[model samples]
Target: MKKNKAHSALLNRYQKLINISCDLASELDLNILLSKIVRAACEVSDAEEASILMYDPNKKTLYFQAATNLDSQLKRGLVVPLDGSIAGWIVNHQKPIIVDNPQKDKRHFDYIGKITSIECKSLLGIPLMSKGNVIGVLEVINKRGGGFNKEDQDVLLALGAQATVAIENSRLFLQSDLIGEFVHQIRTPLSALNAAAHLLKSNRVHEDQKKKMIDILEAEIEALAEMSSSFLDLARLESGRKQYNVKEFDIRDLLIVCHEIIINEAHKLNLLFILDLPDTLPLIRGDRKQLKQAFINLLNNAVKYNKIGGEIILKAIAEKDRIIITISDTGLGIPEDERSKIFEKFYRVKSHRDHVPGTGLGLSVVKQIIHGHGGEIDFTSEVDVGTTFTITLPNEI
Candidate 1:
């Protein structure tokens, strides 16, 4: 009877492991998945709290990326030592450790308790390993029951393995997507350059045709250069490599500046560019340079696609704690069928492609910058009528 019961217990534990592994594999968002992994660790190990510290290979330090009991401020970029701590030891040795009496252990980092405000009497740490290399550490603190046992250790290790694989897959998927987008974006400009060059090489070309071909080559080269720069900038923004230089500034000034820059172009198109902003508008907080780029892109689009004699309005309104800016253009509006795809990377409206020259990345970059500021953007448009883009930015960062 004892042997039969032990076999059933083993089968049940394996079943739970299978279910959790599947869950981890299915989660794709890095932040959400990391939080889930820590939460799952607490659940499977029967611990009071859990945290995940990802290893920074360059810095050789582990930073608190996710936790169950810690606040966002404490978890963000909070670093733990990789020299004398229990987690550090796990990484160095690539093993799972259970400290029933953490006070007695010399490897415990006491400052961690002070930093996170979570008392630690015990800890169970497992190395998040991938391909024989220790990537990070998973730690569960203060078991709820008497003490952590072999079962808890086994379950945590299983969870760690599944999390490691999922994390790698998520990162690689992002890199692959960026590469694919870069390729797709550069193809058109490159083809244009190639065809222009081939035409210039033909001896049958007249003087005027030769000048036109050379102009095409020069224009395409500049376009290609600008596209490459924008791609790298957007990539850095998305990858968290480029930090935002956040500042509080007057929203009216930005609108006025954008109008001044695009007004000439609008005039060339026979369009009226107007800016209507309240003098006492609330001060908005964001990266001023980045926001200016976003504004320029929006206003430029308003003019680029506007019909002759049409009007472009840059208007701003303030709510209780938000500033709503609307860029409305009496331009060639987007079709209902293409509206859903306009924001996608390298996606331009099919009908407008031949008429308008664009790389299709402007709106996407604008969306990214807005979202990074903890704001939202929405738009509404009608075919042949107009399109209005409304951006809501909070007074607070």
Candidate 2:
């Protein structure tokens, strides 16, 4: 009779835990869902602290994403080694572990204590698995009443499973939004192609008119091709399907190459081309080809939008732990309100619509490439004064 009563109580606790998890999964907001997961884990398991560590497979690092007791922002992006850590062990084994004494455990990482300034006594960790692969680890530390037991481990594993599904759902929602925008961007080129075909087929068209229609068809085709390529690149980067090939390269030499490549176009427009690079600019670690593409996009825009006989300047300098490269053009600048949307996919300034010709994907692609290298790109512009694009990359190479 006594054993039966104990089993009944355990069943009731399990049912309540499942109900809480169901509520958590219903949340569509990612930040709120993460917070609820950790909070529910701590509440159900009676732990002093709980944390979620998300894994970045590209970087091969585990970063703390959220926590219950610690300052949420402070714990975020704190990387832990993939070897000889308690969380790493759970990730590798794909199992739940209940540690009564974390300090006595060989796999316990001491660096965490240095950051949080708290001595961890007990820990319970489980792998956050999706589709049979470990995406991260969910852990609760310092059990409140006594120490973590089998019941706590079981509850944490259940919570980890629910959290994984919710995270995947949120990511899918975001991707669908981006895909919809990309689809809409292709319609303009398609309409132009249709119009060109109609004009070319007209029987009354003269030879000169026929030639002009052919040029329009060719231009539309080229624009479609360029837009398609940019769309693919952006999708790959945003979906985490592409990995950067990082290497050390000289920034000075890269600028020189860009200057030489665009010199002819500058001359055609009667624009003065200036290259202001230091003799000892630091080496930057990134994909050389992608960086070149980013620079070319900026230079192309400068030439396309500049007034005749204006000047375009490319400058590079070394800052602390980073190399800053700026490309400035005395061209038509973007309006203040439209500046924020310039880096968005298929977003172009309204003022430049009639004056410049582009697919509006150049800056978006450039931003994605720079972000893939763990860098940042920003710009400042004043109408009719000039626009400047500034890129900053780590000098870790």
- The number of the candidate with the highest TM-score is 1
Candidate RMSDs in Å, in order, are 5.9, 6.0
Model 1 lDDT tens row, 107-173: 8888657746778988999999988887789999999967888888988888888999998877677
TM-scores, all candidates, are: 0.70, 0.68
Error of 1 at 237 (Å): 4.6
Superposed model 1: Cα runs more than 4 Å off: 1-18, 29-35, 38-161, 237-250
Candidate 1 global lDDT: 0.81
Report lDDT per candidate: 0.81, 0.81
Looking at candidate 1, the ten consecutive residues that score lowest on lDDT are 70-79
Give the poorly placed runs of model 2, Cα more than 4 Å off: 1-156, 202-204, 371-374
Q: How close to the true structure is residue 215 of candidate 2, measured as C-alpha lDDT?
A: 86
